[model samples]
Target: MKSSEVTSLSPPPFSQVLSMPTSNQGWPEDFGFQLGGTGPSYILSVEEGSSAHLAGLQAGDQVLEIEGHNVSTLGPQAVIAIAQTQKNIPPSIGVVSRIQQV
Candidate 1:
């Protein structure tokens, strides 16, 4: 993807998103898409009112890790490919809840 393609306010193409690695490692507890483009590093651009954005994930925070996997090396395409193998995953983010919170 080109640098001009990705904007901080818009969600990139499906090719730019990644799924949380199912590996039994120390991955981050949250989930969302990773913005891909020429820049300093990886970033998480949460959809407006999404679980991630609602949870306080800003547009510029560097994504350190996902499912304990170092995203810095996987890049955008690799991550999106991995995430695609999973079924029924939403474009916004991934989550698992036990029950409704009081």
Candidate 2:
């Protein structure tokens, strides 16, 4: 994907979205961005068939928000925790800043 081709998309939630694959990190099967780096949590990669990838999330995109809150201050754990609390993976929105060219 080209960096110049960033797209802001709200991918439709699929029926497969569930807590079937729970991560040891306390996240469900919905959001699949690997968190890491120096300061803020940056998207390392998006799983090919994950809900996050289907939602237009890309590797290198800066995670700006989780749900309706800006997690830049609260951090990714707090954001991820929200997803962990749901029985059924609820619809959560992520605001990422990246332009993909794929």
Model 1, 25-91: lDDT tens per residue? 2112234434553432344455654445556655555544444445545555555554444443322
Q: What is the C-alpha lDDT of each candidate?
A: 0.44, 0.60
Clashes of each: 2, 5
- Overall local distance difference test of candidate 1: 0.44
Find the candidate with the highest TM-score and give its number: 2
Candidate 2: regions farther than 4 A off: 1-30, 86-88, 98-102
Error of 1 at 96 (Å): 22
TM values, all candidates: 0.39, 0.54
Model 1: how far is 7 from its true place, Å? 47
Model 1 stretches astray by more than 4 angstroms: 1-34, 38-41, 85-102
**Ten residues in sequence with the least summed lDDT for candidate 1:** 90-99
* Model 1 Cα RMSD, 1 decimal: 17.5
